[model samples]
Target chain A: MKLHNPITLLLSLTALLLSQQSIAAPVEYIFINLWDEYVQQTPLPDPHPDIERRFLHPDINIDKPSVDQFTALFPVYDGLKIDTHNQLAIRYGVRQTPYRLVVEGKKVITREALIKAPLAAHADQPAQDQTLQTLSGHPFDPTRPGAGFRVLFFSDSLCPFQHIPNCERRIAQNNHLSANIDYPVITVIKPFYVDHTQVSAYQQRFNVNHEIVFDSHNQLFRRFEVTDLPYWVVQNRQGKVIYRANQVPPLPL
Target chain B: METIMKTNLKTFLTGIVLLALSATASAKPYPPLQARTLADQPISSSGKITYLKFWATWCAYCVEEMPLLQQAFENSQESYQVIAVNVGFNQTVKGVKTYLNRYGYRFPTVFDASGSITRQYRVTGTPQHILLDASGKEIYRSALLTDELRQHLATLTGDKL
Candidate 1:
């Protein structure tokens, strides 16, 4: 006549909550500002008015290279990881001052785009699979349709700032994933500074023993809309994109 | 009575004119790009379909793709304008000119000394191609000479190449 055992029900509820948390990855807003020292401290034009109104508080200042300032401004957000060396800015390829982005679980959204549309509209967009020639001289399709979780790692061999801690850690994580049999990882090199011939050396240099594909013509970048380096996207067996972030996300349990 | 009717008609016409002006003003034009070329010539889109190629002197891919851009420039002569913008990343004006002269590539070049124009377009990498239609709306953007870019150019200018 009892509905359930109290101890068993409590454990079941905890497991249910943990499962939900993993499924719903945390959404973070990463704001990268060009340091004043990098460029002459000239009076810059005001950012887009909507940027001020929607994304930032009026009192929070930007364009200064100070960890204290960022920490003070973004005290509440867990995703506000400070990069004192401006490595994140370089990784995101920030050419302008005060670049802002919304990392909603897997999707990277721009400030203006996010303002115009709801996050749901930008969610679960499928990553496009292109036929690329792998280092082994075979046409490789990254989107292993109906396979287990496929890890697409976007790395740049010639990235000047690849030595940075965050970048190095991401590379190490990929290397570890490369050896793992559960995740079929493919390192997609940026075509800007990398050619197919250099792919082998990149592998040897970084000890990236996994499948390396040179994204020729940048079709994959355009299709996936990824502009940053050391990025990762994980797609499930059904080819449904579950997660994508600048840094590697944890593998689903 | 005739005078009164004429006054009302004049007021209605003014209202319509103001409405039309507001509509056009609200239709945002593309970001403005006005700069002097390395050869000291002023260049702007000037209501023409303009192609912007963001490149740096040190970028190897940019060096390799210059010839294709030169051909595109020569082919889309009257129908479109091509402006090669030096991204101004640790590059000097003299170095850019020397490189251009060495190659004998004569497309209009803008040395974005302060990276103002480059920042405006948010160009992250070199050899980035951006094509705008005559109306100044960006029609295409790519990192390489893709067939899609060629198709966009062909459709816009009726140029087979």
Candidate 2:
């Protein structure tokens, strides 16, 4: 076998180089960090910096989201956008501060998954469907396509201030808003310090006409990444989020 | 026309005064805080006004304001006490230690590993400053370190900003 032929040697070297290059190629990532400046200042148990720092490689690009809306009821700073609806936060299902989303090619690896194992070998999987039930015991899936546009109204029966009458008024205002909306609105009661009985009582007290779902385990809250109460997410018939805001948006007349 | 202008100005001024009054009235008592310091020491309640600052290493503004905070902490030693609360989002105790050591910030820090203290205070974001009086009444809460805060500090510490 004449293995020393110039053409054969060149082909062999070229194959070896191609294989090495493929092995050495670094994966590129876009690191989207969704964080609040105030929350960053406030004392909270955040993700470990060491774990998060793994994404800060040369191949990873950092992207900081911009604030577009004035969301604070009482503006803390001249440009503070607290309570404002952030598109990236909603898109990534971010609930806590310093939330990291690593986008590599077509796969998006979450902080929780990235911290657990090696990112290079990890396979992208579809999100698990959470089992949800309505107050009437019927199975409810927010992702399932319905006939018309659906409104997810994340509400807390009692405000953080339980004693204040303004809390009641706020609940009434939300209920009224839901009643007026042309789209089918589903009221999801928060699981934090709230119970099914409180939701039922709230329905009666506020005369909430829409279907009320008690998120006993905060499954829906986690699914929607709802950080604040009185949050609204509008989804089209195809179950895609078209609009979301902390404050209810004016619907079509 | 001059009288009408004066009347309009009076209404606007009265509205501003009422708004200020309402703001003062709305200042609620500071919620009770329970947490351990960086040294794992439990915080003891004091009669002096408490200045709570929430900060994280990831927040550029929080890091930028650290020097000012340290200065305020040093100056207000007699009149008020400053507690730097590390909003532990994406931060570890060891990481916080390294940061403080690197910057030489000696202000007392509390690692909110559970974020309970922040939640109790309803802190929405970082660099949140809360000034509580001797009776634990929240006198001021703001995201930005305003001139008013500086004046208040100067008045209490007797050190002009």
Candidate 3:
């Protein structure tokens, strides 16, 4: 069978793996990670209502700016010393991911990482779908089903990795701890791609008595701002936000 | 004479104990499900020894292990029957059949769509191996199958794995 561009898929999975391994520094278009897939949950119709514009007038693509030319992108740093997208590119040394220069009437404000293509602007107020049910699939209002220590699982019981004994043998080998007390596990599921049935079988068999919620339409994916499997957000039941675990070393038990 | 009878009875009980221990030393063989032929139907064998390997097209590790399994099958086809069970979650029947063809796999295959069988066997993952004797009794079940297992099969089939 003809395999679709193997290089691209490798690059993508590699990018995801790298993002999880690196330290917490704002990556340029770092959506290659787990929640990156969840970001896709938003259809063409529903976008992020919150006008969290990372850049202004990101449409104007200057010819691949030279390293020094990138200096013009981010004219400001730290305290907003007239942020320029050019200088920001130079600081970050970005030649691959398309970045934009944010300027306000010649006075540069800040350089922000630009999207590859124009993002569909839905920067409105956060209007969560009132249709979300609880983990039990019942109408969950007043009490936040999401307002607690969330445990994100990335298991397809169908996958042989399930037998890797992560749950069974509990190997003390190299572990990838997705959640921490500092960052509770805000569990997410893989999208319904080719192996969705695997996930369905897994959920039906594995989640014997555990609580779970599905992003069937990827709606919840947009809200919590997730895009990957096994990705989690650790928060408190008190509605206090904790550190979101991008990826951490697994705890050896 | 009464004392003599009691001593005789104790000796008989001791002999029975030794026999039971010897039987416990060896685990009995089991009979498992048969594999389907290239035509997608169950293929049976008389006094048959079967190795049912569960695998998928997407798994990298599973793919890596295939050539070794193929080698093992080639090593012993006459004495034992090797059945490859395709545990696929996605893809058309054509896609699966095409893959098997490309692999040049000659062993009979069985397709499980809903993965109900995978669940029934408590199989968490692959490459899983389930061995059966002639009567379809399950003998050995393991997730990490190795050459040692092949050697074990050789003993059951009275051939080399």
Candidate 4:
């Protein structure tokens, strides 16, 4: 098998190996990477270059995804759409992603909050479908200290909003929002996305300073359901999606 | 004498207006770029179609329905070729390589360094399809390519433009 298509090769190998092993053994493992979720939340980061070099070195152990191995670990999910999975992680009666569901047959078995541990049974759906309150990942009082709004800024140093050739008005469209308003915006710096230089240039030119977070694994982007780049989601002082200019919905096809 | 003065003033105003109009007409709303590849190769000629589909490895829509595009490419490569350009100007070659390998996106991807092609084509989002003619003129544009479009392309190019 060609090394370029190692994912398909691994799947094929698993099938053959499983057939030879005892029936009691686990079937096979598929890592449903959610990098797409992260690409929309922040720009690529500094550690990306060193991490990327290790991925293409041809000597590293790629058996499992590790934080320092963003390049190789994420290829399994490259060019993949978000429709194959659901917004699995939910809080305050909301579901979110990084969700793993194990199925043996037609019946639903279990769903565990943990990814390392596979679930034995699927839990029943929640009774209440609608909760009037805004979305909050953590349960905290809105009036408490540091309990302000969370501005999930999905940007990439590589795909900066500036110099977007004018055709990509979305970048300017996302930038037009008045950030001088009330609560602060949490900017997630995703430097390793489509292009890092552009993102860097934009940050330098704009002189952005805010609640900056890093998503080396892209976990936070998937949580907010952002699809397109230069996306902005406004969570209230209570951490709810009050307004989002680029909230990517589920795939139609 | 007063009428002559008024006529000359009107003539001067008309000259100013004409110059302004001509200058604006010559200026490009989005000027063409001089982006060169790693080997200093100029950007390849965009195939004849009205709408050009620009996508990136980071764009989810571009990745998900990739196999469908491959099918389209295979079905009608002779008469019509869909150039799925990759916006890797800001991304590393290795990162983009991983993405291309993962999705099996084996199309003739033209790289955008200074975003000249993006501006020239007037593309705003990923997975956007522009249909151009034989002389490189845009005729149709859409954010998403539907099944009906695939069918229509099949009929238009006799294979699929």
Candidate 5:
């Protein structure tokens, strides 16, 4: 057989590099159990039996891959069984499950965005600016440029049930972040026919270390389209919305 | 004198019947709650006003509301009973014990590991206060620590707080 030419060798090397790049792209399935009912109803549906049979079978002699690699190999349609009692979910700031996250490298692609458009279509957009007044009557603007990140926490003070626990968790998480990390958290009390007294009561109820503002005019709520109590929006230093969810985001450690 | 005795006897029987009827009307039976405490002692609600507080160690609001529950427990020693039911849905017995120990909370706590009792009571979150009257009928249920709850608890326990 004739020896391969230099051009042929270069072409083959380029093809091999391209294949490696494709394989190296991080595409992982992040399965999280958001509700107790889901865990009670296990074993969850095995959506990718072929993948499970090929990679997870006991007969396979392949070295057990790292958690990231194992998740990467998981089919997009499949769900993993996770213990609701586990602390790992809590550490990730996951309060409930059916919480699916499609992560490529360090970026998180929310299920809503993934369903609406392509993953690349979800881009960091500028957070809308709105006038806000603190409980002490100080003017606050969240969209103002700052050095570090700002967290806009929207909660209803008079909400007796869900928002209470959620706000308490947010306070604890914010305190932790404040002590360990450098970030400003602004808690906006969304107006729900609540007066200053109720707002004050809520403020005193939780050990809130951040500034508490009252959006009595529903400025931020309308601007952000927040229809739920105990919602959160995180903005980067450039005043761009980085993360928006009902649950408080884990400190970017 | 004979007529007077008859009248008194009639009054006494009427009072007895009324008392029995009142007791029957007020005391609706609650779902049987039988569970083991962290100390491995069985705790159950009896024919007294019961304050069933469903809580978990991981819940921040639950931890905050514990002191209030403890106060109510201390005050309501004679007139009623306070049982802190640990809704251990996503918690371990060991964790609950550690939390109770760490907080030095002495409120009688029972572990509902399977959440059956929680489901029966329709408890969705921690620090849920369900006040059952002396007849076992639920009188008050709230997840908030308010003046109304304090007053209701006070009336139930007959403690002037």
Candidate 6:
């Protein structure tokens, strides 16, 4: 019964347990803040006195309802206060403020800032096997069951609205429909110079409600052969492109 | 005899786990970038500090900030290379040239017509500044032109702000 034997046994047991835990529990949630200043800003209008008090005093044990509501939607929310100084910010391509990116682990689950705009309502087509990450870092396979028809929106965040005013108007109209419609929309933001932060600001300004994804590397855009800003492609549950257009489609009565 | 074998096995497993963890902690290196200037000359980072400024003809902020970038570029003097990358999202080379001519500030300008370079750098807006160190690692970045940044650039280049 040498001391080395017991020490080695303990180390082995610890390593085995840790490895098992790592394999079992992937990082379920990551909430990245493109800009810390904007994240600190109140999203709610006319904050409750208790909430204000909590902000003033972090040491206070008082429960804030607003914070509780947000936490309820995301149990394990971790904010990455990113700036130009942060290397991760550059790595992730955060261009603007109030970028709320949710990831399950390595994959992006959804982006709060990207929204979809329907170009046309057409016959069913097969869905494409596009592996996108959700805001919560989950792998979102459009072909998966319950993923319904997806409205694939291809748009540039830095597209000059001055020259193409129609594009801007269409985006506004599409933003409205995406917010009100119950269909599954997947918006692919074409990376220009704009990052998640700028995209978040754009989403806020337009009040968009689609699962935004970044095509920063332009792999998806190239695959789709979309060169224009604010392009829309409709895909059926089976992952096939059915309809593609440059304008927003008319909503059914 | 069995206990001695178990101890060796455990030690080996622990070492493997530590190695895996260490590998994950290291940051990935920056990707290579190649582009042409407005003068049609090839400009790239050759293991020297590089400054990339993303701008656009339509962005008033970008237009206004061009002079500061020019000053920084001129003052840099062999210490660093400054590149004014025009984000050509719905823009033309003529428009960019007009703006450059009006400003008369000629520090190597590059056009991101297809937005490939912009996407690589992850620039989200105009007047975005990114500073890469000699090893091509991103050292600093900012979306705004501030006095503090000017001071920092001055210190890095040994030039008067």
| Top candidate, metric TM-score | 5
RMSD of 3: 29.3
Give candidate 3's error at residue B99 in angstroms.
1.0
In candidate 6, what are the lDDT values of residues B25-122, reduced to their tens digit? 43333675678888899988758788888876545346546666788888887788898888774356886787688768889989987666776776
lDDT of 4 by residue, A149-177 (tens): 55556655443222122324444443443
State which docking tier applies to candidate 2.
incorrect
- Quality of candidate 5 docking, DockQ: 0.01
lDDT of 6 by residue, A38-86 (tens): 2243242232342211111111111233234334444433232213223
Error of 2 at B155 (Å): 0.7
Ranking by lDDT: 1, 2, 5, 6, 3, 4
**Model 1 TM-score?**
0.40
**Chain A vs native chain A, TM-score per candidate:** 0.45, 0.45, 0.31, 0.33, 0.44, 0.43
lDDT of 5 by residue, A5-92 (tens): 9999999999999987665554434333222221132233343432221111110011222223334544432333333333333333
Which candidate, 1 or 3, would have the higher lDDT against the true structure?
A: 1
DockQ for all candidate structures vs. native: 0.02, 0.02, 0.03, 0.02, 0.01, 0.01
- Model 6 RMSD in angstroms: 24.2
TM-score of chain A of 5: 0.44
Candidate 2 chain B weakest ten by summed lDDT: B56-65
Interface RMSD of each: 16.3, 15.2, 20.0, 15.2, 16.1, 19.0
Q: Which stretches of candidate 2 lie over 4 Å from their true place?
A: A1-32, A35-253, B1-25
What local lDDT score does residue A185 receive in model 4, on the 0 to 100 scale? 50
lDDT of 2 by residue, B44-77 (tens): 3346688899887765436656777898988886
DockQ of 2: 0.02
TM-score to true structure, per model: 0.40, 0.39, 0.35, 0.32, 0.42, 0.35
True lDDT of residue B7, candidate 6: 100
